[model samples]
Target: MTGTDEGRLHTAVLVGPEGEHRRHRKARQKAATRIESTARDARKAQAKARRDAEQAERRNTTYLPSAGESGPAALRTPGRLRLPKHQDTSATLAGQYPFLAEGGLGSSGVFVGQDLYSGGSFVYDPWVLYQQGLITAPNVVLAGIVGSGKSSLAKSLYTRSLPFGRRVYVPGDPKGEHTAVAEAVGGKAIVLGHGLSNRLNPLDEGHRPSTVSDVEWAMQVASRRRDLIGALAETVLDRALSPLEHTAIDLALRDAVRSAEVPILPMVVDRILAPNPADDEDGRLAEDGRLVGHALRRLVAGDLQGLFDGPSTVRFDPSLPMVSLDLSRVAENSTLLSVLMTCSSAWMESALSDPNGGQRWVIYDEAWRLMAYPALLRRMDAQWRMSRHFGIANMLIFHKLSDLDNVGDQGSAMRALASSLLANAETRIVYRQEADQLGSTAAALGLTGTEQKLLPGLGTGQGLWRIKDRSFVVQHQLHPAELAAFDTTTRMTEIARKISDLDVPSGISNDQEES
Candidate 1:
């Protein structure tokens, strides 16, 4: 340490060559630069190889087609997923993905059944909903295929509502499906047909309201009688009445009213067919009324006589819990069906317009049949429009929404009326429909793609309910008693079951078996 330190100190003291020190520093810097350059080139080579391999793999890769793979492999092949598993409470998870299901319509109204989406009980009441400001209209339109249990749903809705002090009035039941139900619910079913002793006078002064004066009622009765006579004529004629025909009907109805406190259709037909000279004024009045008189004559003395010819055997009691006109016997005759439904609707209209009628359900079963006539369809449209004012809910049932197409010619008044019925109905309950029916059904209902898809897949008693802007998929539950009362498949499927239950053997009557 002594010798070396001494030599170094002597060299430093001597101020060794400054050019030598500079050379040493420059050499060290050059060596370090060479090492860094070699390392950079090596890295570039490795990166190039990696990029080439990636490009080659991309070119060789095959992707699934838009229509997916063919054969059994179709849509089954996919890239492996590597997402990390997640764990969280449902409430916290809702923060990320919310509104998975509806909160529900609250715990009011009638208990309908189960809500498919919310996994809870569903409830619906048009009146309740209207009162709550959720809907403005109380009318409902129900469409479903035959045997789809739509009838059951309708029965359930109305019957369950009876306890709430609501009344039901089925103006025309073509199949008589509601007869048993009406009787079971302590209501009345007026069965009228060709052979039945029951009779109906469309001119019967229906229940009078205390709000109207005697003079006002008189005017209303006159106006109603005149309209009824004209409507009956048009229904039988299958066309609107001419101005001359209207005059004929008015004169005939006035004459009938003068003759009796409550005149029958026969008297009106007679007066129109043979107008009194003093009233005719013009000789052509008889001729002008001939066609209309004959058209109405059918209801009194012709083929359509048995039901409306004589004084009404059964009265229209608006105070009853329910009143359904059973037209099953007359359903086979189109003209009879139209005429009877027209009369029945007029009968119901008076009670419906009564301010004291309270809340009621006016059901038009097999509406397609009733809608065939222009006058009847118009009347239905009027009733639907006035439902809110009268505090009544009108439910129009259809085998399918396409039945509306059969009402009238395209763009005709009847068609517009049919469309309006759908528009006024804020609640639309659709049960199972055929594949072909989905398009028009969806179009008429304003259903989403999801709701439309739900139509064909619905089970029995299941319906997609669109109440105003809200949607609910409900599974309607039925009591065994209701099931028995609402069973329409009796003719098609229950005969064998009934037979098997008999203690007697097949083909053996009870008397014969006992003998």
Candidate 2:
């Protein structure tokens, strides 16, 4: 039974299996066709992309003029040959009037945003203009209002002078701005007055009284009483009275002091007033009585001894970089004292006549007052006269242009004189100034248009420096301590302390303490 049933089922099963196998083969064929279609599509796409790229390359490689010809040779064609109307004119103009390129290196040895040029000629680097050696020495007028930092520029120059081994001298006033510089540079500060003699121990470490000549000169300059100064000069000069017979009076006086016993001023005065028994009708004495009287007065009076003796008013060391003379206390005295001391120092330095290529810098802080003294003007002139020979440089600092106006009818003359002094300087540094004042002074100094425009806008410690052929505007930087030390109150306190340390007599101590 099972064989018969199995035979029938087997036959049916074989038929079903054959049917399933045929269906499976059809499905495999359909899948193979779809795979071939996908590959064909991909190959077609790749061929199309390559053809498009080649076509684009061909198009790019081909260049044609608008007239439809190829290359520069096609320019000769009529349509392509049209020239611009102003081509020749533009070419000619270009040849004659060249364009100035901006943003390039300037002649001043600095790179600025733009190179200044006039008709193809370069102006200068703004920084180099300020650094040029034009306004470095004495007589160069610094005109600016308070807070303009004109004084700071002066101080910066003084500081720079130290590295060069330059000697700087400043007068001490209560403000003592310059006096601080002297102390910083290890120089002397001289404070003189009635009780100052006692309070300032001439025997102290670095203390000494000023020379008799120095004292007289100080009296002449600092004496508010012009009559007193006039009398002093007359008395001092009278012993050698011949108008044409000029003597080396300073030298002669110095010599007399070396040999004398009494105070020099009194002896000089007495000799001048003494009637010359040998003189005849003519004012001239037969045997040079003026010389003898001068000698005798210098010898008898303590003039030379007073100057060279203990308690020197001015203590100086050539090795020290700078010397500051405090004259703030000398306000009771004439402004003339400052002038005399300054002039005398310059004269003495010149007299020493050492020329070993070392440079000496003498700075006058608050130089405005110096203009009042003719002797100072003369000394300034003398500095100019001797600068080239001695390498001595003078820097005169002032608050405003008006400070130089005290020269009276010779105002213009004085201006010219000052200008000459400025011209001799190798560098001119100008900081912020009042617009009107800066404009005028810049014009006078021959600053260019760019410099004139930029000067008033300069920031603190920023300035214009001019040397021989170059000019530049630069921002000067200083140490924080230096800035703090220069403050007015700080400076005054320092000078007061220095004076107190002098250890003069009680009276002098009291006077200094009061100061």
Candidate 3:
């Protein structure tokens, strides 16, 4: 009985487990089918939801309803939502209107009053303008009528530039207006005249640039002396020297140099007139140099005496803020003035070429006097041409553009050179001109009709600045100190003050008293 029970139990266990396995398999298969169906439904629902979203988006993104069309939509007033046109002052609109105003000549340079057009501070600096590609030339030509404040403007330009490490070289202040300015700016003014004992030996080896080597300096001095002597002879003779004359002058200069540590014009004149035996063996040397010697002798014994007859009494200190040759004492004598300018120009040449000299303002005040002499004009032309290379800004001041006509004959090379000065100077400042000067000034400056009209109307301390192709009507504002320092009408003002000081009657006013 136990054996049969054991067999049945074993069979029952195997069959029972197999039946359970089959039931589990059926349940798992049904669960998997349900899961598959549920997943299929979920996928269908997702696709429907995605399609609904797409339809909603497309509906929402349809063409904006037309102006007339009404709907529960963003009420965009059709036809661009026009508003009443509005206007406001530029000062007020500056916030709304960006970039309408000039960003200004970047605030890096000197403050030169305000721009009448832009209604903002106008700044000017030749170096800054050059760096910014606004100007390729730094030389300036300033023209204005008498009592128009052009002189004040010129003085201000250079004096203001001094703080920026610039030096001023007023080669020839014929009226001596710059003497006070020179002394005021911590500079020296060399006043040479008939009795002042300020002898300016033209042969003096003037300032030698610190950067030049001994050899280069020697060559420069030799070349300068040779050129100077020739220029002097030409100035006196009123013509360029011949090659033979040049040779004779060169030989005389060499002899003078060998004879003294510092040669004088008298020595050169002596050597030229009374030739050396070796050089003038055939007497042709003396004949060739005869005219040049007599011409140069004018500096020593001729009417042009006392100035260049001896060594320089004063040294040209280029390191100073200003160096002005005050020629007022000798203003009546044109030859003496020309000789002094020539010597001073030679004295300044080395400093001008000095790399360490930084920036300089070479002001040629009363340029009319300078242009009268061909030698001086050529020298000025050379300085103007090389202004950029030497890092100097030359300012040639004139009473009017027509003053150039007084330089040389019509269509002459001197006139052309004078005109070239205006051409080379990219900056032209026209203060105030008479009505008659309008056409010539306008044509010479290439001023527009609008600009031409502005010349005559310019007031005191106002200038029409034509810088490179850009035009600006600037009202040069000076501080009280500047006005006091640059007052050119002091003589008239003093007379007025004296007239005003006169005891006025009970009913009379200061104006009446002045009148």
Candidate 4:
């Protein structure tokens, strides 16, 4: 500043104290820049030393080329990866991939439950399956241990089908389980028993199909009546009828039909006991029918009287949504139960024979009791065989598959008839079964090892549905309303919560043994 300011002294005087402030600011920035240059020199020195060391290290190191190791130790192959294609049934392939499930019965028909394996909704309609050709038999065999929810499933199936314009018929409800369901669905329950005014004439001309001509109908009715009377007698006798007994029944039935416009069981019984002189020209006719006559007489004049001795007080309406024969009143009487079932079987036979009966559900609930009689069991086998021709679906419910063993002795005709009921049904729904029953049930239905193991672990409303050859583990869903309406344990449940010990019998189990 002394050499330069020599000529700038005059301007510095004009600049005053402000010029001195500017000079001091410039001096401070110059000092800071000097300090920064000193720090930058130190950094450059450190960088140069680092670069030299790195170059020395690089000279000592070895590396591979960009194309990778150039030797046999490269561990690389020239060929691309490949995999073989697999071919097998879905079921066999599912073993290779355990997460897979049954390609469910498609999204059509009734939504009965959820498919446990597929993680999708499960739908089942016997007729739908038949239409899809997945099953040729529209009949179903439902088996489960007592309180295993078979009853509820049966009810769900028929009730759900009502919306699709199908009808239901419970030929006999020994425990009256279907009575409420029948009533709830706007149908009639023909409740008949002792002390009740209700009566069912076995000879009542039942529903005549529109497709039948008068002559054809007459012949049909006559044949049905004759067969029904003989079947009733056989039921009461606990064995098949002889040729002579059959002849006497036919002759006596002819006499009754001629004598009364609408004949009753008593008329046939009286004619069989004391044959009309004109009809029984042979003196041996009365003796031939004595055993058969007395057996039927029990239905009209003995312990089984009052329900079928006169013209029917109730009519079997084919157009109704459902019809259930309530034999609970006489369930205690084996003879009476068989007689009622035999009579109702004829009623249903007439309805089923009609071409216009539409699609119907012929359910045999508590089938074990019905099969005890040879006549009813024979009719069941016939219905199961002819289910396709009749446009009707039949469901045979059992407490367990082993119940069929009680039908008759091994290799007996009755045993074969009972076995035929299951043989014709392709849809077998199995709920929770007892440990002892798993073997027979699995063998009878051809369940897979996994399916057999699944039975014991099934919760309520869970069932293994084997429709034809395919299988699904279904969890049946119900609406709050459907659940409340379908509940069968109301009696036991009500007896628990409200009534005091002194007012009720204490045998209530917290868990419902039957749904």
Candidate 5:
């Protein structure tokens, strides 16, 4: 072993050590990779096990009716299988008709309760029921005191209902609650007032100015009140006859107007009421003069101008998603008339003309006032008569059932009419009310004890909801903007801008135009 032999041996030892170190590194890397892959596989298996367990739990929890269960279950099965008494039949029943526990507002499709027992057990979910088309053609009646948040609840309902593409028409003078809702939903608001009318120039717009003929047609459709018509006719005869008459009188007045080629109303007055010297000897003229004179006098004085002027009277275009008739400036009765005339006419035309068959919802905030008019009564009757075919819904709001009674005998008729309307509504909402009136209105609608109990405790924006055949109460939460949108000023500038575009004539001035 010389010096060269010792160096070679040391080099061999170093090379051997290097080879062992390389083999160890490779084995460690392989082990680490195997561990990572095994960990991933374990995690996946754990997740799958958890999912399977959850599915099994759901299957076990879902309700299904037992052998002896009757009605819906019996109907579904032609033959029955006997089961032990301890088998928990109630769970099975609940599973079969989940809606029985949840109610109409629970699922998407319409749920027609099989029995009164099952129907009464239905719960309500406003959001779910509305989305499912289960509550189509809802006629919502909002009843509450002045500050009981009726308007707020109405706004919530309108906004929530708009996503379904239903045409929502709110009268112009909404207590300022629905304006924001209209805007938020991409709808239009037409503020009705003297300023709106004066600025819009409805007469020159060529939207077919409302004639006495239109008024007569509206009246004829509106009421069977012959006395009201007779009174109106006599009033027209005494002072000035606009060339319009009842359908019975249209031909005669039209012929006269055509022969003279003059606007009819003023001319009719001249012919009927201008004291005729030729008739003085007949004695018939003097005897019947008083009644005719009184009738004509009242007709001329009784705001007939609104009839002719109303069509051109500051109406919002139906093309807009929403139209608000800002009747804040108009007298209450006059406001009611204006809303009834405008909305009813627009609805009639839309129902007749629109081919796509869209549904339109007309919401009346202080609906009792419109119910007072025979014309409005007739319109509502027509709406009810035509609702299924025309896809129109009327959402009428009143403080109480008795508020409807304020309209006199007409009120009673309206109440009966309203009952029919509610029957057609499919969806009914009864919010918080005084303890006294609560029981009666609730009973009238056939609400159960549980429902009645729920009514008194309803919070703001909360109330009972009955969709189609089911009833339950819910607390509705509104978006902040929606709550604030009811501010009157939100759409004022836009409305003013629209009015400014109308070719309104400058010559006509109205005392009501002072704003």
Candidate 6:
């Protein structure tokens, strides 16, 4: 091997195929770069196309018109719907909330009227409420100003209940308004006045309960007589009888009873005025009973005479649908009225005690007058307390809620008793009242501010009923017959007529009236 040959062999060989391979490799690299560039561009274009399509779709989308846009579209076209804000108490709101109102008392009792809130019939019965445990006491306190239709509501509630086998007893009707109602319901109204033939003998054996035996009845009669005479003395004297006076009354009642089988009031009075020497162990017996005896003498000889000094001409038939003691003629005499009520209460005691006496309503109209007398007030309180036991419902009607304030002093026992009558009664029906009376009425009833406001706006026959824990605004509806029967404004509208006047049309005068 030569040096030139060795150098050539050691040096690189420049072949044409090598140059072509380098060019081919470069071309392959260029082709790969071009393919990658084209794929990247294609991807970029696809992304742009998708973005453009989305933008076009958004541009073409439709939306509801803004406020005041003109087109044939619904009136609801608006930027944002709005409404006026409303606010009310839960009590008033419960009434306004159409679906949230009370379901109402089940229709199992006497029909009252429409429940303004629930928009359903409002029916109430004491027995029904008692049976359902809605009320523990069956008594009612109805208060309203004159012309508010409280009387009619009371009349309707009781009269409508007559068909359900309940009887009514108005122990003292000062206005005689219940006289017609009593007669209309096939009941009796014992109208006792100075000149009337109706007499109420305080000493007569009143209605006897079937549960009472003969000896027991005699003892009860004796005890009732003694208590009645004592009460009479207290009422006439306007003070409680002392112990000696009570002893004297006992002796007189015993002697009177021993002498006559059915002794009258005069005999008891005579015996008290002149006690027998044998019974008067103390010479001061007559002197101790002098004032009491003379006080009781008023019923037999004084201003209160002729009413209780004789036998009971009219009987207290418990089976009657209604019985009212009409004291309208004596309403002007408060003491006399109280005396009559005392005797009447004693007379009613026997029938009320009857186990089979069934359900009854004892109404006390012009209750403010009755509450003034301690004896009568006590009697009423007892009846009210025993209302459930006797199966009776006592109704107290007053001209206004403030009448309770006049019952006695602010915190006196009489006042407490009177207020208790209201407290024990679960059903309190209040009608329209004067604005000035709202505070007292609201305070007495524990009414809310809204209820207090509602009172002044209540229309005729509209009432607010607070039953137990519930409250109701009721629009009392009356039939035409009831309206005519309960009309108290006849004197305001009725024209005076002569007996000799011929039948004529109402709108006709001497010329038009004669027609």
Query: How would you encode candidate 2's per-residue C-alpha lDDT over 162-190 as one tens digit per residue?
Result: 65355565533434567666777676665
* Worst 10-residue lDDT window, candidate 3: 64-73
Q: Report how far residue 247 has shifted in candidate 3, in Å.
A: 1.8
Model 6 ranges off by over 4 Å: 1-97, 496-515
lDDT of 2 at 457: 86
Task: For residues 85-129, write the lDDT of model 3, one tens digit per residue.
Answer: 999976457678544654456687878788886789888888889
**Candidate 5 or 2, higher lDDT:** 5
Cα lDDT tens digits, model 1, 1-515, are 79999999988856768867888999999999999999999999999999999999999999887767777776455564579999987656776864578767778878889998888999888998899999999999999998789999999999999999999999999999999999999999999887789899989988788799999999888888888778888888888889999998888888888889999888888888899787888698899999998888788888777888889999888888989989888788999988888888888877889998899999988888888888898899999999999999999999999998887889988899999999999999999999999999989888988789999999998999998888999999988887888888888677888866877659988888777
Give lDDT per model, in order.
0.89, 0.50, 0.88, 0.89, 0.53, 0.87
Query: Which regions of candidate 5 are displaced past 4 Å?
Result: 1-100, 103-137, 161-163, 171-188, 193-249, 252-316, 332-353, 404-407, 410-415, 487-515
Off by over 4 Å in 3: 1-103, 503-515
List candidate 1 stretches off by more than 4 Å. Answer: 1-99, 498-515
Task: Please report how far candidate 6 places residue 103 from its true position, in Å.
Answer: 1.7
- For candidate 4, the C-alpha RMSD (Å) to the true structure equals 22.0
Per-residue error (Å), model 4, residue 493: 0.8
Worst 10 residues of 5 by lDDT: 200-209
- RMSD (CA, Å), each prediction: 15.0, 24.3, 10.3, 22.0, 24.1, 13.5
Clash-forming residue pairs, model 1:
none
Candidate 6 displacement at residue 423 in angstroms: 1.5
294 Cα displacement, candidate 2 (Å): 16
Q: What are the per-model numbers of colliding residue pairs? A: 0, 65, 0, 2, 23, 4
Instruction: Pick out the ten consecutive residues of candidate 6 with the lowest summed lDDT.
Output: 493-502
Error of 6 at 296 (Å): 1.0
Error of 4 at 360 (Å): 0.6
